[model samples]
Target: MSFRVLRCLFQSTVSLTLLTLAIAPNSSMAQSLPYLEDPPPPPSRTSQRVRRSNPELDEYTLGPGDLVQIEIFEAPEYSGEAQVLANGMMDLPIGGRVYVEGLTIPQATDIIAAEYVRIFRYPLVSVRLSGPRPLQVTIDGEVTQPGAYVMEIPLKAQSGLQRGLQYPTVPELIELAGGVTLSADLRRVEVRRNSGNGKEPSFYIDLLSYIQSGRRGQDITLRDGDALFIPTAERIEEERVRQLAATNFAVAEDSPRSVVVVGAVNQPGNYVLIGGPSRSELRPGGLPTLTFALEQAGGIVTNADVRQVEIRRITQTGGEQIIIANLWEFLQTGDFENDPILQNGDTIVVPRTDAIDSAEVAQLANASFSASIVVYVVGEVNKAPSIRTLEVPTNTTLNQAILQAGGFTDDANRDEVDFIRLNPDGTVRQETIELDFARGIDEFENPLLRPNDIIVISRSGLARVTDTLETIFSPAPEINSFMRILETLGIVGD
Candidate 1:
């Protein structure tokens, strides 16, 4: 055979072998290959159900402090901009007070339309929530803005950045609120939502995923009145293992010693043995006192019951021991006999009290501390302040700091002004300063004052005593002694 023909014959033989293998399946091949039905292509992502807005089923409700716009078709006289009153009613021009409490915009519109029909011919009413709707969401735990944020819109991960240049994330919110303060449990973030029907469902989002993986999807959307709780990390339980490995706390390898302090304590959690004096020196055997624990837990909560305290302890042999201690008795009298010392593996539970007037106390405290050493008046200001605080530095001239504090209080005397500096170390220094208001060179040529320095304006010598009193009482007191007096008298409560 020729070389080309031989090559063609070989190719043909190879092709035939492949054809035979492709056509014929061997028993071993069939047995070796396990059958796998392709997983039914994953359930379709497209939902079939039509999206409907069910206001009644939605947990959020319309409330006061929300701005709304009302329009009455064919009855322009009744249409106007109105805010929801505290009573949940909006006064209309012709419709009187329309009860709109707990109604959505559409629902409110329908109700208003129905009411108008009784008085008018086929009255068509439309209501639109015009302002940032009031939402009762708590940006708590470790949020930058840890408070009640109005959930005007459905909160999404994208909504965070839209608010401002420095938009805060779930983690950022925690950071904004003083970075969880001191004892924030960042590992677990709890988001709780109230069902419209009164049931509350809590969802736990693990912070570790976001912190470790840099995943933004982990940041969950919050609903109105949703509560986000970042508990304190379980330090006692885990720290014990580290302590045992290091042998730092003198915790015996087998000795069962642990204590759990919950409720109203600054650090309400499990605590392990630390090789040192008890937190309270007053307690016998240097055992941690209720007061000390409470202080560590951030002081007693206003609702804490000082009378009812329970301690639960687990013994070495797996036995549980419970004791009831009166915290008030222990606090009032150094009554160690009645209130036993906390042992290792013991849990202390503080009950909530009914007589706790936390809100009233907070209001009074806020009123008392209303003095701002630094004041600023922007816009129509001649000079601006560089510093505002109670403690003005020695280098801070009154003239310069006042310029930074937003300049003289309208009728401020340029020459007759002095500033007082209260040192943290208990020294009061006074400075006689002159401001060259005429000259536009108001910039502080010398060292500017630090923050929290106090700036005071001295009246001109010709000014009367009554004028001075008027100036003194002009600004609202940050801490109103009158309010405090009323609080002490129990005449007013927050």
Candidate 2:
């Protein structure tokens, strides 16, 4: 259903009534329900003093902190107002102390009326309840706070039909405990309820159905002492996570999460990731994604295996779980699941591939997770600085790096550059390459540069002779001091 339709359904009295009946414990239409599909007939709305369900825990009754007004039609002296004490006893005119806690209004009124029979031959009694005690429920797994929560009876209802009678539902219970984590799987929320027998029975609910489609019976109306557990999803997809995050069920944006990003990244270390901006107020940024971690760690290296990226997480259920992020597949098919959002304490590992394709490097260099790389451009370009360091994107070519550093100066050797690249095995590959911008990019031409590659743009023969003469006339100390001054001014970039 569209959001508008879902909101409208949640606002209707008929919807609440149907939801209540359809999810009744014994009703066959529990979690398997496609729709309301012949919901049980609504219970008669006669003055039954709020006996909504037959189950002991599900029944609504007077409790401690309740205010009750008792009336006797025939005998005015026997009528009075009483607040139930902590011990669940109320002081009445005739009954003196009657235990009314956990009893329906009419049930307690009858007990009080029987006590008044001694004062009058024919005694009629009525008891009204107000300020019903808050419902106490326990929530565990995937919620911000997984413990007992006291929820005030909310006044807002679709209509007054369910206005005074609506108890807290599963959604309200979740909100009470704080929003769910990114790992929460709303598809199979287990609500453990008192079966009235010795054993507590659990019912699995697809809460997303109710949230998205306004399906009846999916969002169980919680009762006092109900326990809800939101299990973590085994796997995730981007769109599904985004859909839930847009709702209040997901964590809020701007939340800071500390994480460790290691393996095959330029800067492999700890990082603090901030939640992305709210997609909109209605759809908060929700949670930081794996790409957010990559961005924080200075991007993946050229040999990174995007297909086998791993996120090691400490699950809400108290064990570690490893989830794979197939970014290569995501790149191919636009699957958001390949780049799932993250929770706190996640360790993202972008493993290295044994064999990397050049095309893959080109593709990932343009990915959002790509960060800058440092390359030394010495003996090059501008006359003022003979040596300069340029921080450019990974896979930036020799030509691109040169252009970014203001290109070569007028005296620079136009035909060739000395390229020195460092190998991971602690060896250097040095070569003098001929420059031809028109020939396009290739291994022998404008090859893609790696981290810490060195490029030398030697001066032309005439410029070299002029520099030799200048060096002969000038002292080495003065030139060294001038270079030192530039360093002090922070003009020679790193």
Candidate 3:
């Protein structure tokens, strides 16, 4: 027989057998059947689901300024829209005013259904969230901009649960505040959450751990009335500032920073520097360091003591934090750690070396931190360019400057010359140094030239005497005397 014909015959036989069994329920065949027994109960929601890490999105907690929708199967009058009041109470059609604040929508629905049970025997009620209020939070300390921020959140729920809603996290708030400074301490970032209660609870999160590992363990979502505080780093060395600077939470590398470079540096003053690390060839990453800042302010002077470069930084407590940077070590060993990175308002003081070594001077002039300086040489210079100014290396000595200016004129003083320097304290220091053009460059006799230094080559004794006699012997004096008499006699009539 065909499969369809076999299935039909089987169904007819089963129907007849069930009818026979129904007619004789106490028979032996019916007693052996256990198919009518009840099945076991399903599991509860509490046992099935685990609490999500993000509390704001895990469940929609009712609060002030939120809209809730209720539905009762046949009782339209008792089921409509309601709003949570500022006092956490919601006015319903049946339960005058019910406190639903801090409770989930399902919890509020159960409470409302129980209240309506006294009036209506059967009330198949349902609840949903229609609207959510904007969140207002504050982030302070170690951030580029510390202030209040308002985040608007629009929500709609058809199943009375949060779906595909992305809540803001700790790092997102920090980014809104212009990102954290390189000196920020991410280990102890604190958050103060204000639940409807009068008490505010506090919690700490270590962003350093999160940044190191991609695990979002405790980077929790922020709620309304939440306050975040990122404290200043006690020591940048401990925090590994270079690593932090490379993160997205840190300030941008190209952003301009105002820094002051004084002491033994060319054009020592305030300058707006903007750049990234370009010196670290040994290690991988780098940052704008003391050497970089010096290059921004013209460059270091010839005799700068790179071994003890002082960086005076302003701490969070308004006190000066002095850090010593050694660029000489960096030049020798290529250790970028010897050249500490620069921060906004940092003052780099390249102190003057007590004694000058000509060999070191040559190396300093060739160093990347040192720049070519301009010096003015006036008074009987043979070269046209050096007569006004000469742009030479930082280690150029007095003899070198004179030779670069074409070895001075015939009447130039070979005995002594005046070296005028403008001091950093707005003072002009002029000193006459006895010169011997034939002598080699030295620290005392033929010292190195500084930027904007004025070398004054005086006239020789014979040249000065000849110039004085020229004035007395010239015919121009006689012509001036005759012209004056002629003007008195009106011979040259007006």
Position 348, candidate 3: lDDT = 81
TM-score of each: 0.31, 0.71, 0.71
- Residues 204-278, candidate 3: write the lDDT tens digits: 998888777865433478888899988877665723776677677777776667888888887789976665555
Candidate 2 least-lDDT 10 residues: 42-51
Tens-place lDDT per residue, model 1, 432-464, is 555554433222322233323445564444454
Residue pairs in steric clash, candidate 2?
11-158, 238-337, 278-285
Please list the C-alpha lDDT of all candidates, in the order they appear: 0.48, 0.73, 0.73
Better of 1 and 2 by lDDT: 2
TM for candidate 2 is 0.71
Please provide, for model 2 over 1-494, each residue's C-alpha lDDT reduced to its tens digit, 9 standing for 90 to 100.
69999878778977776677656632433322333344333222111122232232224577787777676654466667788899989888665788887787657866676555444433445665545667778999988779998877643443322325457778777776778877788899999986544678898988777757745342368876678999988865557777777776566666667889999888899887667655542222546778767877878877788889999988788767788889888878977788888777889988887675667778878887877789988885873477888888776778888888888888889899999999778999999998887765466678777788999988889997787567555656865866654554567853
Error of 3 at 427 (Å): 7.0
For lDDT, the strongest prediction is 3
